[model samples]
Target chain A: MLETHDTKLTEDSVRQLVREEIQRAFKKDPAKKQACIISSKGTLDWAYPPLILATAAAATGMDVSVFFTFYGLNVIHKDFERKLKVSPVGNPGMPMPVPMPDIVSSLPGMTSMATTMMKSKFANKHVASIRELLDVARESEVKLIACQMTMDVFGYTQDDFIDGVEFGGAAAFLSEARKSHLTLFI
Target chain B: MPDIKEDVVLDARNLLCPMPVVKAGKQIRTLEDGQILKILATDRGSIADFPAWADDTGNELLEWHEEDGTFVFFVRKVEEED
Candidate 1:
């Protein structure tokens, strides 16, 4: 026999209870904050997100690692300064202090000019440089991994990369990725 | 006028948010305990950023000031006592 009482849990009350339970559950099963960033492109803009996010993650006291594969190796390579270049021919989202028409943006040499302007703006606005971000990552002990398979494909030797970079592959990344609560492919 | 170290001058002029703090974070670790760092930055956000960073990282904010165009910050490396 089932006795149905005239009782109803209000939506707000139910929500509160659920939130409390979730909080308690999370506290009990505390997850480690780990992130894996896979950088596949060699562009200047493409370089920023991984470095920024990795550094910010380290700032948040998380275990962060970056896996540079293919063209991404240029970012952490010794010749990065010369290898990395901004190309306006394809980048539409690149901001300009003064708005320019697509034609102007698509024009030759616009990328170099735009790159210079953006770098200067970054400097003027106190935006951290890629070099500085890398230094921060290093200081914070963020692990940097260069994809071994990609290195072989690209014919990059160990000397091609900056110091303190480890060589690994997808399996290595997945091993870390499985433990991480946050994983990003950029 | 803040204490200056032989090798720890951070020229953050024309840089912005995370950049200033990021640079300061990197440079601060290189300095030994009690060594001072002078940060010359144009990023206005650093007025507040460095103080917060100092607190979080256990470094000491010795002094800070702004002049005609640049903001100056002085921080002392406080060793993270084991």
Candidate 2:
């Protein structure tokens, strides 16, 4: 009877150990839940991807960070609304109301016209604007990091950026990227 | 349609990709465990996005259906244990 009891106790302990091991395997480490993104373009159309992905990741309960370098700094700039514009010159993919030659698209004021058209089209489609996306990103606590080297090259001061922006270098971005399984360069 | 009582109603109509899920995520934070959130979105992407978002956030997606052009989702909040 004692041997049988000892055997039952051993079996119960083994089962308990297996259950704990299974739970440990299934439980995701909260610290590793992160997303890192690099936004490299400044154009109005190019700005959406990073912000959209960052906000979505944050909504899914993951920490998100967006590294803005080069022209991508315009996304965090205070004058982003005025600075971000879409240019039709040398861009054949852009759907135009009327097909125009490259020369016409290259003419002065074409960029502004293209920018306006794109903005209106997005608005009509109920797509979130850059301003709205930034608001959501900020509210969701998605880290927006501006590359210090790019800011210096572009003659942008720390004061030129919008609120909640952190100044960082490539190393800072790499450190964050290393910890995240999802990293994208856009 | 089976009546599912919701603790909150979020109108994310006409919002594009990410907005519906983003807003729904924000709205769901206000609810307690097991409280239901009803989301009305016009974005076609929500059909796929909501399920993915629910699964990612550890929330329960009770049911989803389409009415006219709107996609309706009912999700139950599952509070995470630290």
Q: Who wins the TM-score comparison?
A: 2
Residues A153-172, model 1: lDDT tens digits? 88899988888899998999
Error of 2 at A127 (Å): 1.1
Backbone clashes in model 1, listed as residue pairs = A123-B14, A123-B15, A124-B14, A125-B15, A125-B16, A126-B15, A126-B16, A127-B16, A128-B19
Q: Write the per-residue lDDT of candidate 1 for residues B1-82, one digit (tens) a residue.
A: 5445434789988776666776677787788989888889887877887887787567888888898889988888888653
- Estimated TM-score per prediction? 0.64, 0.90
Interface RMSD of each: 3.0, 0.6
| Cα RMSD for candidates in order | 8.5, 4.2
Q: Model 2: share of native contacts present? A: 0.81
Prediction 1 global C-alpha lDDT? 0.79
List residue ranges in candidate 1 displaced over 4 A. A1-30, A96-111, B1-15, B20-82
Highest-lDDT candidate: 2
